[model samples]
Target: MSAWVFDLGNSRLKCAPLGEDGRPGDVLAFAHDGRALDAGWERALPMRIEAAHVASVAAPALRVALLEALSARCARIGLASTQRAWGGVRIAYAAPERLGVDRFLAMLAAHSRGGAWLVVGVGTALTIDLVDADGRHHGGRIAPSPALMREALHARATQLPPVGGHYREFATDTDDALASGCTGAALALVTCSGEAAAQLCGRPVPVLLHGGGADALRPHLPDAVHAPALVLEGLGCWAQVGRTP
Candidate 1:
């Protein structure tokens, strides 16, 4: 039986086929802002599916819309949520629900690879989490992404462009300066976090970068692994364990 996984974030909805080997296949993304599903997007789904697993951090209305859409073509549907412990990973949150499931799934996926890791998600917001080699969650930090910073700055100061600029150590123009400063801040945070995580874990913690904005920061950090489909990969892991809501 064929299955599928969906990750609904604040900015986009991503889906992929779940292969028998328990890995996510090619991903498809649809950008939305609490609107109805696109006609083409609906048409794009497989005609029928054995199971549909979803991890959603979008608004409730949007989540409902997606679930409704899946109900028709999916023989079974599973909604994923944050958990204190699951599939070998133990979360640090006093209230596990406080942590975003996307983040949890990313850490879960990272732990499956068998090593301490500094997982960074750069999307609508920048989120960083650390999971030790033994799957112990070390909590994390959150900050506005470069794009969000740019948008906020543009909203406050119209003279500053909201987008379009290259990152440089010392930018001469205002646009590049804005881009450099915002991107630099995110890079610095990740670098600092990685160092701290290494000290705490007593080993070098490799960085794993994911999310839509990751490519912008990838060139700056050569060592970080780019895994854009990490959340979906983790969702696949979740389904593999037979836990679904």
Candidate 2:
């Protein structure tokens, strides 16, 4: 039987069918404004799915709307939550629920890859979580991702275009400067975190990067593995544990 997995972020919704092997099939990405989903949201999903697993970091109203829409087609629906421990990864959070589910699942997915790892998620926000070889979480940091930072700046000073151009180490123009500055901040954080993780674990820490904004940051992160479906993979891992009750 097939199961569907959905990862709802602030700016996008990604879904894929879970195969019998517990791996997700071809992914479908839908771009959404903060307020409304695209018309393709209805047509993109299958008419009937055996099960639906979701990990959402979107607004509550969006969550409710997506769930309500899926209710008609799915035989069962499971929502992933931030937990103290799962799939051998022990969270460092004193209050586990305070940790975002996206971060938790990303760690879970990293653990499955084996060895010490630094997980960085680049979306509306940049989030980094470190886990050692033993699967103990060492906590993480959250910052406005470069994209958000640019958007905020433009909101304050309308002269700055919110979207345009690309990254340059030494930008000669306004658009490139914005791109370089934002992406550079994310790169600096990831590289520094990777260095720290390596020192703590006494070996090089492989970095795993994911999320919508990952592409913008990837060129600078030569050591990182870009796993776009990381959270969805973790959702599949979540489905494997007997949590489907």
Candidate 3:
């Protein structure tokens, strides 16, 4: 029997089948507009899956809808939630529940690689987390993502466009300036966080980038590894343990 894992984020919904080794297989993604999903989207899923493991940071409406759809096609369903510790990763949060499941999952995936890491997720938000080689989560930071920053600026100023324009060190036009500023802000945060993580962990850490907006920043940070399926990869681990929250 084959199982599937789902990662429902603020802007998109991603899913993948579990492989024989319990890792995620080819991933499929769909844009989420906070509306009811259509039958065509549902048809894209396997006709029948042995089980479904979901890690959702989306609104309740979409979460419930996706679960309802999976219930009919899956023998069992597992929902992921933040935990103090899982698979070797020890979260630093005093109240584990306050931590985002997506962040926790990304940390889990990073820890599984057996090294110190700085996990960065760039989507609706920019999230940074630090984990030592022994799986001790040092903590993390969150701020508006580059796209969100651009959107907020456009919303407030009206003169600035939310999208388009390439990033430059010294942008000449308004559009390019907007792009450079927002993206540079995010990069600065990541850079500062990396330096702090190095100090706290007593060594430099590798950066693992994920989420929808990661690509936009990848060229700037040449050392970071792009792992778009990171959340799903963590969900795969959650499924393997047969744990639900």
Candidate 4:
């Protein structure tokens, strides 16, 4: 049986189907505006999908729409949550239901590979979550993404110019300096937060970074493993649950 997976982040909606091997196939992405539902998504839906799984950090309305769409295309539809336990990881969020499903899934994906891990998702917002070697989630931190931070600065300050370009490591002067500094700040927040969590967890956690901004932070984070599709991998794992003996 095939499975359809959707990861609805604050910025975008990513969808894909899983093959029998539990790997993503036929991936498609749409803007998270809710208007994209009626667009050509039907054409993108695979045939013979038996189950559907979704992870969303958006409004309840958007989640409902996504589930309705998937239900129309599949026999079974499921919503992903931070509550599920997998491998050695057990979620420790004070309000597990309030925790972002994407963060939980990413942590699970990191843990599946084995070892203490720090999973960072850098999208509309930057989130850093930790999973210890014993599979216990030690919680995490969240901060504005570099883009949001830059935009906020430009929006609030009249003289500050809007900056746009590839994030560089070393800035020769002020222009590159500001851009690099903003980007560096975001990366530092994530790294420092992860490191702190690792220390609290009493283990050396290997960092797994994901999201669109991951590449920009990679140079500064020599210790981090880049996993662009970490959330998708987690979605695949969620889709497989309860399907086997």
Candidate 5:
């Protein structure tokens, strides 16, 4: 049995099929503006798709449309949520209903990997989630992404130009001041959040970084491991469990 996973985020929709090894096989990403599913998906759906799972933070209407399209292509469809319990870890959100499903899914993947972990997702927004060694979720933090930060700065102030460029490790020089500063701040927040989560767990926790901005932020995150397909990984995990009973 094969599973298709879709992670619909604020800016993009990422879809992938999981192979027997639980890794993404045919991965495709599209903009959030209601584009058709990739042609590959059309060809792949007939190849015995047993289940489909989705996580989205899009508007309700858009989410419905996405789900409907997915339903047309698969036998079973599961909506990912922050409220569900998988294995041992349970979501600890103050308002679990309001928590982004993507964060929850990512944390699920992180917890499955074992040990204490801080999962940081940097996309349109920054999400930091902590899972202890005992598989207990410890809540999380959210903040504006680097792009959102730059946009806010530009929108609020008259002097600062819209900052655009890749993040680098050394930014003391003038040529990369704005880009470096923004990157540095984002990385600082991620590391600090990880450190804080570790402290709360009473031990050091490994950091798993995911999302679009991860590559750009990599230079500044020395202790973080880049796990680009975490959402898909979680989806695979979900699919595997669904088959058992």
Candidate 6:
């Protein structure tokens, strides 16, 4: 059956047709603000689809906009939300709704592989979640992503540019310093979180990393499993087994 999966984040929108193989096929990405969709983005989607599934953390308005657009082209639509338990993974949060669906979905994707894991999503924000071999969500952390860190600094310090520089072990120049410091900060956190997750699970856990900023974070994190379509993969999981709340 033909379906579609949409993952709408704070800064971008990604969608793909669900292949007969039960996985998302080619991805279509579009730059988006909380309110704006890129020009011709709508044209990229197929004229009609059998079903559409969404994993959205964009503003409510943006969520509405995209889902509405999809509704016109799809016969049925599904919105995925954080569940108390999903695909063998039991959420750790006392109030599951309080946890971001993106994190929950990432955990689902990781658990699909059937092992203990530290799921790290580096996007507009850096989200680190821990799930064990037995499918227990131990919890996670949230911090400024490297880009967000740079943006925070730029917003406060006009002299500092938000973009540029390289990651150096010991940066000597300002540009390198900003890049190094920001990237290093995130890397350090991922390391610390990984260690913590390992301790909880009683061994080294595999790290499943995904998100927009993941490429920048991945170089420093050599051990992480690169799963670019993680959230979309989770959306596919939900489509197969999850029911809307």
Overall lDDT per candidate, in order of appearance? 0.93, 0.88, 0.90, 0.77, 0.77, 0.88
Q: What is the lDDT of residue 111 in candidate 3?
A: 79
The C-alpha TM-scores of every prediction are 0.97, 0.95, 0.97, 0.87, 0.86, 0.96
Best prediction by lDDT: 1
Which residues of candidate 5, in runs, are more than 4 Å off? 34-48, 165-175
Residue-pair clashes, model 6: 0
Tens-place lDDT per residue, model 5, 1-245, is 66778888776778887788766776677765544433444443555567778888877777887887767667888887766567566878667787777887787788778898888899978888888888788888888777777777779874666765555567665436667777777777877887788679888888899998787687777778899989888877766666677
Better of 1 and 4 by lDDT: 1
Poorest 10 consecutive residues by lDDT, candidate 2: 236-245
Report the alpha-carbon TM-score of model 4 versus the true structure: 0.87
lDDT of 4 by residue, 1-245 (tens): 67777888766788777777777776677765644454676676666578878888887887787787777768887877777466446888667877788888898778777878888888878888888877888777888887777778889984666675455678776557667878888877876877697678776677899987677678878988998778888877766654656
Compared with the true structure, model 2 gives a TM-score of 0.95
User: What is the descending TM-score order?
Assistant: 1, 3, 6, 2, 4, 5
RMSD of each: 1.5, 1.6, 1.7, 2.5, 3.0, 1.7
lDDT of candidate model 4 versus the reference = 0.77
Q: How many residue pairs clash in each candidate at the backbone level? A: 0, 0, 0, 1, 0, 0
Model 3: per-residue lDDT, tens digit, 1-245? 67999998887889999997888999999887876654478888878999898999889999999999899899989899988888889999999999999999888888777899999999999999998999999889999999999999989999889999999999999988988999999999999999998898888888999999998899999999999999998988877665545
